[model samples]
Each structure stands twice: as structure tokens, then as C-alpha cells.
Target: MDTPLSVLFSSAEDEKYVLDCMAYFMILMAACTFVCLLFKDASYGRYSSSKYGFLVNAKLAWFVQELPAFLLPVCLLIWASSAKSSLLANQLLIAMYMCHYTQRSLIYPFLIRGGKPTPFLPFFLAVVFCTYNGYMQIRYLSHYADYPADWVTNPCFIAALSWFVAGSALWLLGWLINLHSDHILRNLRGPGESGYKIPRGGMFEYVSAANYFGEITEWAGFAVAGQSVHSAAFAIFTAVVLSSRAFSHHKWYLAKFEDYPKTRKALIPFLV
Candidate 1:
């Protein structure tokens, strides 16, 4: 009695196992992020603190975050250039994780701008989980799964490429919007300013958290590029988490500033 469920499960035990592992890893990552945020809040002692002053040093924080991201891409390129299918998959997975690490490592610190350093414990845990899970994803892709190199040349590949390109363009545009907005906000604050302020202009005009919007877009692009269930799951998780953050930020902006832009929505622009 082979039920459909049984058949589906039986056919790809390894893929299922990999997916399960990834799911668990995502859950762990989410937990780690939450814990880090909690620690950050406790250490910073609320968002109202004027002692450390508001506004972390953007340049310094950016440098810290960018270091790993820069290095990881180089590693990915080297790995990707090699012809082994398993290694290629592994490299792709590593590249995905590295992309994420680069973003989290580089972006969050500078974005804080003067809060207590996000609790090191949670941050450290996240790093560990990402590193480990990323390794596993790569290992499975390289060693366990076999995919065609011309996977990219198939019709599915063409479609996936289209999605990837479109998604990537949107993602980059979102990033630019966020980056420019951040620049504007930073300049507005001047030197030695502390505390979060309502971000104005750019996508901030439409959404309270443009930077987050961009971040989500970036990962969504990756998911599109991969065109796999695993990639889609990661992107979905990222979107949900980031969207929540965007909502929270939006509410905070509305509460904190009388002059906060009225036109902008929370996570979506003029929609949600």
C-alpha cells in the first residue's frame, strides 16, 4: 500500500532530509536573531538611552560587516569556478550563507548607530549556526545530489534566470533606495547624534523600513536564482522575519516622531 505521501517521501529521502535540516537551521537562526535582539535591548537598556548617544558610527560598523562579506564572495568565486558538480552545489549553498552573513554582519551593526552592541552571545550563536548549516547545505549539494551543469541552459533555467534577473534588479533598486535614504538620514543627524529617528525620503517615502525592504529583496533574488524548494523556503523565512522588523520599525517611527512621514506604510508601499 504505497500511499502518495509514502511515495513522495520515499522517492527523495535525502532531499527531504536536507530540507528538514535546513528548516531546523532556519528555526535556530531565527531563535538566535531573537536572542541577540533581546540581549541588545537589555544591554542598551531600552531605545531611549542617551548615554552611548544615538547613532552608531556608520563607517566603523560598515567596515566590520563588510569584511566577512567581501571575503566570502571571493571564496565563493574560487569554489564556483571549480568544475565538480557536488562542489559547485556546495559552493552555491556556501555562497548563499555567505551572502546572508555578509548582510547581517555588515548591515545590522552600523544600522544600530550607538545602541549597546547587539548582545554578542546571540550574534555569536547566529554566526555558528549559519556557518554550520551553510556547510551542511554545501556538503549535501556537492556530495549527495547531482544536478546538470546545463541546468542553467534548460527552459526551466531560462525561466529561472528571468526571475532571478528581475528579482535581482528589484533587489538592487531597493538597496539603493535604502542606502541613499540612510545617507540622507545620517547627514541629517550630523556628528555625535544618538537614538533612532524617523527615516524620510526615497523608499522611506513609501515604507518605514526601506533598508529592510532591500534586504528581503536581496534574498528573494537568491531564491529565484536557485529555483529550488530549499532556496524558496529560506527566502520565505527571511521575508517573514524582515517584514516583521519592518512593521515594528514603522510603528516605532510613528510613535517617536511627530514629523514622521505620513504617506509611508509599514512593510509594503501604499499596500500593506
Candidate 2:
């Protein structure tokens, strides 16, 4: 016998049911993330070990995991019928998501320099997450979601648009910082050199995990702009995961480097 949830998911016609399921799943994921905070995900950088069994090149791992976020949306749009005269704002929001994933999946992985091997487990988890999230966001925004025809001139819409603009600006700024910070970390080693170095300059002067901060900020802004449960869930997830990683990185830095800056925080500039 087909369960109600299973039937809803299997049917292409029940878009609302699918989105509700996605929302519920995100809520569950948020709870799971809280539990996961008690234990670190054992992959990436110094944490990488053979305990998880089997590893893939970091670049390959990142590319494959992130690919679904970019590709699934494109595929969905091509095959799924869209609402006629879809709001321009919705289209732009979809573009923003695609832009972020395009960079993450295609550009950022290639830019990585001598990254540590990623364990198969975490890599697989990431792929599943990206695919699930990509489908939820793209399908809702492109096909099912609708806005008032007068939304462009409505005061609420105007305010939401402003919120989105502000969020996008913050997101873009954070992305630039993240890219620059990654570049600095990548160059910390020479052709034959392989070891950790205290990252200096830019946001690193104040925070041990500047790139993490940038990413967290980016998604948080996206959530604010998006003003949807789906976006909010993603933002919360990012914050929880990245903040945990930043704390771990901070602890590792403190233990490893005797001359590490005493004033620098973990993810936040000075608060955390």
C-alpha cells in the first residue's frame, strides 16, 4: 500500500504537497543539525582521516556534491510547466540561487589548491542535500509560487524588495570576502610546502574562520530576502554547520600555533 507521503512525492501533480514535504524535511534537518553539533563531521582539512573509509579528491568531491544544485534547477525549469507571466522578482531570486551554486559547483572547486581528500560519507551526504534543496527552491519559485499582480507597486512588496536588495548586497560582499580569504589560504603554501599558516589580512585579522563567516552571512541574507520557510531553513542550517566548523577550526588553530593572535574570534568578528 502506498503511504500518503510516498504517494504525494511520487506524483508530479501534487506540487503543494511536495513543497510542504520539503518544508517539513527542512524542519527535521534543523533538528538533526542541532544533534549533529555534538559531533563534528569527520572530513575536510585536518579532520580528514581514513576512519570513514574510502576517499575522493577534494575537488572531485566538491564538484560532484554541488553539481545537483546547479543542474537540477535547470532541468526542472526545462521540463516543468511554469506559471504564465511569472513575477519578475521570482525569476531574479531563482537566478540568484543558480548564480551561487554555479560558482560553488563549477568555479570554487577548480580554484581549490591541494585540498585534503574528502571521506565518502560526508561527500555523499552533501550530494543528497544539494539535490533535495535545489529541487525545493527551484520548483517552488519557478512553478508553484505566485505573487499578486500589483506586487511591484504594493508597499509590502516594496519593503520586501528592499529587504532583498539589502540582503543581496550583504551576500555579494560576503562572497567576495570568502573568495579572497580562500585565495589567501590557498597561497599559504608554496609548490612543495604543505602546512597550516596563520591567515593574516582582511577579515582573518579579526576572525579565525573568515570564509565561514562570509558564507554564513551570504545565506542568512538570502533567507532574509527570500522570506520563505525554505530559505529560512537553509540559512539556519548554514549557520549551525558553519558556526560549528568555525569553532573547531578556532580550537585547532589555538592548539597548533603558539603565536596565533589572541584577540581573534571564531566566526564573528568580535562577538563570538
Best by lDDT: 2
Off by over 4 Å in 1: 1-20, 24-113, 136-147, 153-157, 174-178, 181-185
Quick one: RMSD of model 2? 3.7
Shift in Å, residue 266, candidate 2: 0.2
Q: RMSD for all candidates, in order, please.
A: 8.4, 3.7
lDDT, candidates in the order shown: 0.55, 0.80
Q: Name the runs in model 2 displaced over 4 angstroms.
A: 1-13, 149-156
Which residue pairs does candidate 1 place in steric collision? 54-194, 54-195, 55-113, 56-113, 56-114, 65-106, 86-142, 90-138
**Model 2: colliding residue pairs:** none
Q: What lDDT score is found at residue 136 in candidate 1?
A: 38
